[model samples]
Target: MNTMFDSSNPASAPRVWEVGALCHAIGDALQARFNPVAVRGEISGFSRAASGHCYFNLKDAGGQIRCAMFRRNAEQMGFYPRDGELVEVRGRLGVYEQRGDLQLVVEQLQRAGQGAWFEQFLRLKAKLEAEGLFDTARKRPLSTMPRGIGVVTSLGAAALHDVVTALRRRVPHIPVVIVPALVQGAQAPQSLVDALQKMYLLAQSGQGQEADLAQKSPLIDCILLVRGGGSMEDLWAFNDEQLARTVVQSPVPLISGVGHETDFTIADFCADLRAPTPTAAAELVAQPRELWLGALDLLQDRLESAVQRVLDRSAQRLDLAAQRLGRPSEQLSRNHLQLARQAQRLRHAMLFKLQRMTQNQQALQAQLPQSLQRRLEQQKQGLERMDLRLQLLDPRLVLQRGYALLTDTKGKPVTQIKQAPPGAALKAQLADGAVDVVVTQPRLL
Candidate 1:
């Protein structure tokens, strides 16, 4: 046999370099066999290639893994992870043919762990805000003095006792009804919400049944969710998204007093008002006895002052009227006497005016008869002159004076002989009669 190859074949066994090449090919085949995967880690060394591919290492405390995010994949991702940013990557594990190194081909990316939860919170907040759940118009105003108050909390919790004690201190006469339920743990969220609904139903139905006994309660006016301080996980029930939605959907006004002064939860945002502590919530809902007394005292002082002012004004008016009435009657009597004298003078002037009018009437009456007599005398003289003129103008009067008047045909007076024609009829008038005669011939003498 030959040293390089067996005598049966001219070919020799592959060299170390060739074997290395085969192993690289096997590794690439193996990488290609696996499908796309998702892995959550922090970005350790991130860099962008000129070809628009992102090269980065996904790392944790214990180990690190290299990854390559193509431009298409980067575009699909909502946010690109920066260095130290914890993220989840979905991709396939494959060997780089050029470098013979194993790497991830990223397809999708998203924030992981706490970042995921925060993002979810923001999404829920935005959804509720769009629905008008966090609107000021939806928030109910608290009653100034509610007849009954409802509390939802754990039975043995100190927060409950604190609220009860505070409420008693502020308003002893007001009634408080507790709906015991867990404020933490997996079942806490549902239990709190159920308790709230039960209280609301009881208030609406006018019936409150106890687990151990039966008793009816007055209408509940407000609900307070109180709990002690704890870590985010421990208080996770209060931060529940469903519970937050439930609080906003509740028709009654809700007061959230979860955790301590420094603690806050999602429930706090949905509630109508947030209190620093359970004690503070109770104090806000109830009026302090001392404060009520102070207000009453101020009102009393104002009433007294108002009454005094009114009395003072009335007394001043009465004094002024009395001073005016206290004057003597003699001055009034003298004024009346002056008025009477003025009236008498006016009456005398009127009587004088009447006397002058009577004298003028008598003068007119005396001149009436003389004026009538003068008119009658003038009328008689005028009548005599008209009579004389009538006698001179009358033809019968000339005849009566013994002078005959003659008229020819066509009734023309025969004062001139030339008026008659041959054989014309002529009329002669005496004093009382007229004679008709015929003119045989005309005498023009």
Candidate 2:
């Protein structure tokens, strides 16, 4: 102003470091104008960088903020933000010194309202619902009396206990199988889908020692997808379009009771049956004990009636037989005297039969001894004849009649002269006794 205050001072002129620091401070001050701000706006201009960073804009009626989300933070969010989707952002405002661009380092991004999420839900629901997923014709009717009931719920959730208790009260003997799963939050949707698939496969495969499509270790019959009442946000998992489709396509009839009496989800529309609450669902699947008891009473009455009918028929038959037995008359005893004469005639007829039998027996007895003596005499004569023939054919008798039989030392008959080998021992049957000799030379004759 006055020629550098009459004396130019290097310190007062500002050092290079101080000038650089001043510029940086001014940039920071500009950025501070928007720092630590909560911006509610629909996401736009979203781009993921090659460096694993996300670039997006948060814009509302008033203004917009450029947001950058690192890969680490972006991966943690359940839903990916798209353009025109309402989202809330929390970040620190900053300036890129080189580009001179204002930027926000996003620490959080969430749905601003039911606007975008509801719209997406509707779109998906319509798409799947149109595919017959929500068709009433595709739904399976619940068995009046299910042999077993399967429940899908979070293990520690109170809804599980409510369902179990309700089912037990309605039908105590029906077995209840619990397939534990997460029913809320990011994991809830997939967990529910998996559980539904498992039950469906089990029903399709039938009772056997084989695995199903889900490859679950244990099997089940029918499935009950249930959860306690909660806010729309809390029940959002069941509202998932994929989960709803799974429930609708399930082979096993699925009962959906995802919330309280007032609560409903997309799954409710697609399920085979929708119950207002978990307990109600359980009751729907189980048979009422009172009805079964009444049926038993009816059966007992029928059995009693049948038994009585049988007994009455048997009594009637006995009375008829007794009446027949009491009427044992033979033409009024053949007019008394005539009946007595007939009785005598029957006795005489039987006695004649006995007398004939006795005469036959006596004839048989007389013939027995005569036939025996004749047989004995004939047997003696036949023996004498046989003895005479034996004497004629006997070798001893032949020897006594002066005929001799020559045999080899081995008792072989010397029928052929060649059989008597030279120098072999021999024996001859003379009229008196055997004469032992030696085979010298065979006389061929």
Candidate 3:
């Protein structure tokens, strides 16, 4: 405390000063006196500006002091503050010259007496991280354009409304299903688990009966877990270990938008994608209709070019084949000439063979007649010779030459006559005549 002029000491007339000078001096004094203080109070009038600066009042049962947290400082604090939260703020105590108000330029803040929740959060986080649950390698990738999307949030939540509006505007044809659940309160975590299971079933089954969609044709491609911004206590349901594990094990990809951009929870790390807001999540899952149409047009142009090139190639091939083919009429004329030559040779060979066979038949006919004439002459000569020999041996000729013959009455010729048997009749024969006689005696002569 500067004791330059003590009004209690009755100093000769107190030092007169302008209001601006007085305020400046007080500010300077306050800045120099107290620094790096820890003020325990309940938060009130808490609000964050667009510049990321935080403004609030710290109060107890008796009085309150104004506070300001700059964008740079509050950013490092890692959590947003809400009204009526008991907190201990660390800052430099000072006075604002313009408003003549005492204030605290906050550097950091801690939630008063709720260290156990933070500790539990850290423990579960450590366990999951050790198990590689938050590994980027293990995370699933969201489809570029989901067929259908499922959402798990309170039906009355403003987050749901924002998400629907964004999705419908982007892709009016894409289907969106709401898996309603309590997003806060004691039953919130289990509700989240059941809702996620139902969503996964809906995705795998490709059925809209349980997912509550109009058509059952398209499958659910991704799930969104979203809620509006709230204090850490209000958002604690998302920090449940079971819920985080369920998100990690989801059948389809999951996006977490639980709370504002500055707020985060265990669910955010476990999800396949983390969106800053529900509207952002919806945008990530859908593609604009105009963009899709433009892409299709480009592909159509490429296809037409390829087909034309193929057709040109085919026409060129057909022309080459036509050039390679020869005239069929010329080929047939050559074949006809060769066939005529072969037929002439065949006719000459037949005539020559027939003439040779005729000459051989005439020679055989001439030999047959001569052979028959020679055989007839040989037979006639043999007959004439035999006749001559028969004439020489004739007995009539011998009789004419004085030869005589005798015969018995029996008409047998007898070279020796024993004189006929006594009383037997006999005949004596001359060459020309014969006489009969009777024998009186037998004699050998």
Candidate 4:
């Protein structure tokens, strides 16, 4: 029998492999065992490269694994993976031939049960959103020109320096109030609330002073709650429900500038405005002084132009009035000449009217005598004809012709026998006298 490790037996010697070949063999063994491996652990030092590839370490108390997610797989992730986030990954496990180390080529990655802290954050967010605390309608507009700005942050935070620097650079005239508070750990929430309350007091009544004395310190128009970028645990204070409620209670508009641009917290949703960074919050509250100055300059130019236009119009009116008036003495002389000409015309018109009237009166006098003679003759002839008509219509003339008039007792003329009945008393009226009589019987004809 031949022993495999026997030094004397060449046919039975163990095979030695190159480093690259050994790595390939181990990788092949790992693929055969678990090609589609799924792992669950907390992410550490997660980073996404400019090439869209991601590199991170998944670790547990007992072990850890190096993971790499290429651009394609990383793009499919629903949420950006941060350090200390618990996640599950599925990928091919293989050994890198370069450094001869084991690595995972991740095909899929997702949050591990949403993590405990993240789940709490979501629950609180949902609760607040239901209460309308996160409504866009509730969000207040930031003051375009805040009288003063208040900042609530840690004394040692770099966010404070960044905000102050930006504010100073943009609007040096605007005052800034710094209210130091704990921006991390469990105590940060209460500290931030207290700081904001103090700012409110200062804003309403300068440093607890009376309303009249509030001018001692510029009134705070808006407040900024800021902190530098950090992990979820490190920035957990901003997610506090109490802090979220307090953020909504700010007397002035509150601007939340916590963590990086990608980070979100409960306070951010409740704030009047959300800025990606502390410096951005400062920029939002205070517009550039140069911009305002430029606007004022434009207004001044417009005012000057308007004034010049008015002056030009007035000057033109004055010139027109001067041309119309000429000199006062010359104007008076012209008015006198016009008046004299009107007087001369009036005299000539009166003379002509008087002459015409006289001629008309002379002509009327000439015709008056003839008209009076003809009228008098015509009136005489009319009187003569009227006298003849009167003689013809006289009742005495009818009586003289032997005709008598009959009258009833009531003095009405009896033209019918019915008027003078048998028992009626009547009178016969002559031209010179009347005689009463009684009718025994009336006869017709």
Cα RMSD to the true fold for all candidates? 36.6, 32.9, 41.3, 31.8
Candidate 1, poorest ten consecutive residues by summed lDDT: 321-330
Clashing pairs in 3: none
lDDT of 4 by residue, 336-381 (tens): 4564454345445544653564465552333334544455355445
What ordering of candidates by lDDT runs from best to worst?
Answer: 4, 3, 1, 2
TM-scores of the models, in the order given: 0.44, 0.45, 0.55, 0.54
Better of 1 and 3 by lDDT: 3
Which regions in candidate 3 have their CA more than 4 angstroms from the true location? 1-37, 41-76, 81-87, 91-108, 111-116, 211-217, 323-445
Best by TM-score: 3
Stretches of candidate 2 exceeding 4 Å from the true structure: 1-112, 205-221, 321-445
Residue lDDT tens for model 2, 1-445: 4555323566556445654566577668866676787677888898888887899888888888777898888764545577997877777777655665667788766677654665666677778778878888887888877766778899899999998888878888776666678999999999988977766655676442332243333344568999998756888998887787677677678899888876657888888899999988888888788887676556545534543454344345434433333211222223434433543454455346535644655523333345444553554454345334423433445567777778776766677877777887788878677888888877865
- Whole-structure CA lDDT of model 1: 0.71
Which of 2 and 3 is the better model by lDDT?
3
Candidate 1 per-residue lDDT, tens place, 1-445, comes to 5455556664655444664577577666766676657788899888878887899999898888779889877764434456897788778887676776678888877667554654665577677778776777777888777878888999999998899899888889888888888888889999988888887786666577766656777678888989987655667788677788788766567899988786667788789998988888888889887776666556545534543454344345434433343222334335444544543454355346535643655523343345444553554454345334433444455567798767665655676666667777898768777789877787654
**What is the RMSD, in Å, between candidate 1 and the native fold over all Cα?**
36.6
TM-score of 2: 0.45
What does candidate 3's lDDT look like per residue over 277-310, in tens digits? 8888888888887887676556545533543454
**Global local distance difference test of model 3:** 0.76
Residue pairs of candidate 4 with colliding backbone atoms: none
